[model samples]
Target: MKVGIIGIGHMGQAIIDGLLNTMKSEELILSNHRINDAMTTYQEEHQIEVVTDNQSVINANPDFVIFTTPAPVTLAVMQEFKTLSAQTVILSAAAGISLAEINAILPEQPVALLMPNTPVAVNHGTLGVALNEYITDSEPIESFLQQLGDVFITSEREFGIFGTVTGCGPAFVDVFMAALGDAAVKNGLNRELAYQAAASMVKGSASLMQETNIAPDVLKDQVTTPGGSTIRGVVALEQHAFRAAVIDAVEASNG
Candidate 1:
C-alpha cells in the first residue's frame, strides 16, 4: 500500500521507522520543506521516494497521509492541497490540533487526530487516537495503528488527558528509573548494571500486571511482605508524596 508522510522531523522519522517495519521502502511517499544531504542519503539508501512539495506527495494517491508537521505547517499544507479527498485518510500527530479544526479545513474528508510519543520508533509506543465522524470503517486504520503501538481509542474530548499521560509519562518513567539507578550505585552496583536492572524490573513488573489482569495495588501487595524491605521502600516513597507528586505532574502536563 502507498503511504504518504508529510514532514521529516524527529517524530516523522520515528513514525516512518515503525511504518518501514511493515511496509516496503517504495511504498512510502515523503514530502519535506527542503531536502538536505541526510535526506538525500536516506531516500537513496532506503530507495524511498522523496518530494520537495506537499502537492507532489498528494499526487501519489496514497491510501493514508500522515502529517507529523507542526500544526500550523500541517494546516498550511492542507489549505494548499486542493485535491485531497475522502479516498486518503488523514492521520495527524500534531498535538492540540483538534479533529474539528482539521475537518474545518477539509470538511468532507476522513481525519484522525493522533497523539504519539518517541517510542513509536520501536513500535512500542502508546498512541491517543480520535477519529472523526467521516471515519466509518475503523478496523483497517486501527489495525494499521497496531503495527505502531498500543492504541487508546477514545473521544477527541478525552485526548488531552490521554496525551498528557501517555506522551509525557515516558519521561517521568525515565526520571524514576534514573533515580533507582543512582540508589543502586550507592549500594555498590555498577552504573550500567544498575540501569539495566532497574529497567528490567520495571518491564517485568508492568508485564506481570498486564498478563495477570491484576490491579497495581494488588500486585504491589503480592510483592510486599510484612516488615519487608520492599514495604519499607514503598512506605518511604509514600512518605515522600510520590503518588501525590505523580498526580500533580499529570495535572501540570494536561494544563
Candidate 2:
C-alpha cells in the first residue's frame, strides 16, 4: 500500500499531509526535483523517504503514483517510467493534461486526471476527477481523494469547467473574503479578528447551502426581509453586476 509522489511542491505536500492521516510516513515516498531548506525541513518533520530521481519513486512499485509536476513536463517525467505494474493507478494533477495524452505514453496504464484546489491543504478541497477505461475499481482512488476532501467525478469534457470553477474558485473567494475583512477593519474591527469573522461566515453560509440543498437565490430570499439591510446589500450586489462579473471571470479562464 505504498504511495509515490513525483513532486514535492505545495500540492504534493498537501497530498502527503492528507495521506499521513490514513497511512504511516514509511509508506510514502517522494521525489524532490529541486530540494531546498523548506523541503529539508518538511522531510525532517514528516520522516518520509525522499529520492532525487523519478525512477527511484517508480521502482518503489507504489500501488498509486501521483504526478504534481508542471503540465508541460508531466508527460516527459511520466515517460521516465518504462514499465509499471498493471495494478498501479497513475493520476495527474496538472491542469490541461488529459488521460488520452498520458495513455499515448503508456497505453496499457490506468490513469486519471484530477484538479485539486489549494483548499486541499486544509482538508476541505474540491476535486474534479475523470478516469480512463483501465481503472476498474475507483474505491481505492476515491477513498484516497476523500482523505483530502470531497471528490466530483465527471467526464473529461466537463472536467475543464469543474476545474475552472473549483480550481480557480478559491482565489475568488479569497478576494471576497479580503474585501469583507477590509470592510470590517474600516468599521474598526481588528484585522485578524475581521478575517476570522469573514472566513467563519463564509464557511457557515456554504455549509448551510450544501446541507439544505437550497438554491442560492432562494437562500438569499430567505435571508432578505422586505426592507432589511440584507435586502439592501443584495440589491447593491445585483446593481453592481457581481454575479455577471463572476460569470465573466469563469468564462475568461477558458484560456
Candidate 3:
C-alpha cells in the first residue's frame, strides 16, 4: 500500500523512518511546507522522494495519508485535501486534535488519531491509536502500526493521558538519568562514564520490571533491606516528595 506523510518534521521523519525500516510499501510520499535545504540533505541521504507542494502529497493517491503537522496546520491541510478521493484513511499524529474534530473536517472519510513517541525511531515506541466510528477492527492498520511499535487501542478521552506518559515519558526518564549522571560527576567520575553507568542502570531496571511482571514497590522492597544504602536513598526521595512531583508533572502536562 502507498502511504503519504504531510509535514516531515521531527515526529514525521521518525514515523517515516519507522515505516521504511519495517514495511515494504508500494510507494512513500513525503511533503513539508517549507522544503528547506536541510530537507534536501535528508532526502538525498535517505533516498526518499520529497515533495515541495502539499497537493503533491494528495496527488500520490495513497491508501493512507498521515498528517504529522501541528494541530492548526493539520486542520487547514485536511480542509484542503477534503476533496481528494484517493486518500482513504486519514491518520493524524498531532496532539490535542481529537478524532471527532477530524471527522467533522472530513465527514465522509475514515479518520484515525495516533500518539506516537520519538522511540519509534528505535522500534520501541509506545503508541496510542483511536479510530473514528467508521473504523471497526481493521486488522491491516493494526498490523501496520505493530511494525512501528507497541500499539494500544484506546478511547479518545484516554489518549491525552496516555500520550503524556508514552509520548513525554522518554524526556522525563532522560532528565532523571541526567541528574544521576550529574551526581556521579560531582563525585569526580568522568562525565562520559557517569552517563554510561546511569543509562545502563536505568535500562536494566526497566528490563527487570518488564521481565518480572512484579510491582515496582515489591522490587524496591527487594533492594531496600533494613538499614541498607537503598533504603537511605528511598528515604531521601520520600522526604523530597519525588514521586509526588513526578505525578504532578504528568498531570500538569495533560492540563
Candidate 4:
C-alpha cells in the first residue's frame, strides 16, 4: 500500500516511523508546512521522500492519506484535496476533531477519525477510532491499526473520554513512577536503581491486571494484608486522595 502523510510534526513522524517499521508499504510520502533543518535531518535519517507542496502529496495518489496536522489546518487541507480519488481512505489523528467535522469538509469522502498517543512510537499505543456513516467497516484498516498496537472502536462521544485515558494515560503513569522513584531514592537506592525498580514494579502490576481477571479492588485487597505494610501505603495514598486526584485529572483532560 502507498501511504501519504500530511504535516510531518512529532505525531506525524511517530506514525510514519510506526508504519515504516511494521507495514510493507510501496512508498511513504510526507509533506509539511515549513521544512526546517531538523526535519531535513529526519528525512535523510529515515530515508523517506519529502514532498514540497500539498498538491504533490495529493498527486501521489496514495491508497491512504493520513492527516496528522492540527485540527484547524486539517480542514483547510481537506478542502484543498476535495477532489481526491474516492477509494482513498482519509484518516485523521488530530485530537478534538470529530468525524462529522471532517466529513463536512469532504462530504462524499470516506473518513476515519483516530486518536493515537506517543506510545505508538514504541508499538504499544492504545488507539480509539470512529468512522463516518458513509464509510462501511473494512477489515484491512482494523488489521493495519492492530499492527501498531491495541485498538478499540468507539462512538464519537466516547472517543474524547478514551483519549483522556489511553492517549494521555502514559504521561499520568510516568508522573507517578517519577514520584515513586524519588521516594525510593530518599530511602537510599541510587537514582537509576530507584527508577528501574519503580518502573518494573508498575509494568509487572499492569501485566498482572491483564493476565488475571480480578477487579483492581480485589487485587488491592490481595496485596493489602490486615494491619500490614501494604495497608499502610494504601492508607497514605487514600489520605492524599490519590485516586480522586487521578480521576479529576482525566476529567480535566476530557473537558
The best candidate by TM-score is 2
Per-residue lDDT tens digits for candidate 1, residues 34-133, read 8999988877776776788887777788888999988776887778666875688999898778888888889879999888898898898888889999
lDDT of 2: 0.87
Q: Rank by TM-score, descending?
A: 2, 1, 4, 3
Span of ten consecutive residues with least summed lDDT in model 3 = 80-89
Q: Of models 1 and 2, which has the larger TM-score?
A: 2
* lDDT tens per residue, model 3, 1-255: 778889899999888888888765347878888767899898888888788686786777787888899887788778888776633788899888877787787886878888999878777788888888888766767787787888998888888899999888898999999999999999999999999999899879888998999999999999998999999999999999999989998988878
The segments of candidate 1 whose C-alpha lies over 4 angstroms from its true place after superposition are 37-49
What C-alpha lDDT do the candidate models reach, one value each? 0.87, 0.87, 0.84, 0.84
Q: Largest lDDT belongs to which candidate? A: 1
Residue-level lDDT of model 2, residues 53-133, one tens digit each, is 877777789988888988888888888876877778898998888888899998879899988887777688898889999
Q: Please identify model 2 stretches exceeding 4 Å from their true place.
A: none
Query: In candidate 2, residue 125 scores what lDDT?
Result: 88
Off by over 4 Å in 3: 24-26, 84-87
Our model 4 lands, by Cα RMSD against the true structure, at 1.7
- Quote the lDDT for 110 in model 1: 91
RMSD to the true structure for each prediction, in A, is: 1.6, 1.4, 2.0, 1.7
